[model samples]
Target: MNAQELRDKTPDQLRDELANLKKEAFNLRFQQATGQLENPARLRSVRRDAARVKTILNEQAAKAAE
Candidate 1:
């Protein structure tokens, strides 16, 4: 998921996406701990995506407040 795509979504959608990303991140960590993670890159990607979503959410909230 890209920032542009995330920006196009509503706040509710963004929240949903963030939740899913966090869940995936947790699963990835579990796989790593279990020694079964196939793609290490995915863990990094999910973390970044979650951060991107958070940034966008903050930006939107700031806009709403102004």
Candidate 2:
């Protein structure tokens, strides 16, 4: 998912996405550790996506606090 799409989602949806991405990241790490990872690039993308979700969440929280 892109940042634009992420910006459109509610906090709840973003939280869910972040959780899923984190789980995927963990699994990817496990796969890599065992040399079973087919797409190492996926790990990078998932990590970045999770960060993007976090950024959006922080923005929302900042707005709410105002």
Candidate 3:
């Protein structure tokens, strides 16, 4: 997903997306630990997606506070 897509989502939706991303990241890490991870790049993408969701949430919060 991209920033524009995330920006269009409600905060609650974004939170849900973040939670899913975190879960995926955790699973990716587990697979890596077990030497079963097929695509190592997926772990990095999931981490970045989670960060993007977080940044958007923070931006919304700051906007609301203003």
Candidate 4:
């Protein structure tokens, strides 16, 4: 949801969350393509959330490397 919350999660949990967000993003895209998407905003939010998870993951990896 938020970076702070995501920061608190273990890498495994973060990966799982990222996967779910990707799935939701794909479904949202499909719904939009079919003209069935009720909330277009959700797509944006999911994308951002996925990005946040990725950023956090990278940060963790970088920290470990250091």
Candidate 5:
């Protein structure tokens, strides 16, 4: 997903997406270990997306706390 799409998600949705991304990253790692992964670049993309979700989530949380 693009940054715009990620930014459009609600906090709860972002959290859910983060969880799902992490799960996908784990599976991708497993696939790489077994030489089944087609595109290794996906790992980097997933990690970056996960980080973006987390950063947005944290920003929202901080705003709420203020």
Candidate 6:
């Protein structure tokens, strides 16, 4: 997803997306280890997406705390 798409998500939606991304990352890793993955780049993409969601979540939490 792009930055604008991420920005459009609410904190709750971001958290849900983060969870799904993490699950996908784990599955990708498993597939890679077993030589079943079709695209290694997908793992990297998922990781980055997860990070983006996490960063947004943290930013929201910090803003709320302030």
Per-residue alpha-carbon lDDT of model 5 for 11-36, expressed as tens digits? 98998999999999999999999999
- Can you tell me which runs of candidate 4 are displaced by over 4 Å? none
Clashes of each: 0, 0, 0, 0, 0, 0
Clashing pairs in 4: none
Per-residue lDDT tens digits for candidate 1, residues 17-57, read 99999999999999999999999999999999999999999
| Worst-scoring 10-residue span by lDDT in model 3 | 18-27
Between candidates 2 and 6, the one scoring higher on TM-score is: 2
The window of 10 residues in a row where model 5 has the poorest summed lDDT is 1-10
> lDDT per residue, candidate 4, 1-66, as tens digits?
778999999999999999999999999999999999999999999999999999999999999999
TM-score of each: 0.98, 0.97, 0.98, 0.98, 0.92, 0.91
Clash count (model 4, backbone only): 0
TM-score of 2: 0.97
Stretches of model 6 off by over 4 angstroms after superposition = none
* Candidate 3 residue lDDT tens string, 1-66: 999999999999999999999999999999999999999999999999999999999999999999
Off by over 4 Å in 2: none
lDDT of each: 0.97, 0.96, 0.97, 0.97, 0.93, 0.90
Candidate 4 whole-model C-alpha lDDT, 0 to 1: 0.97
Output the better candidate (1/2) by lDDT: 1
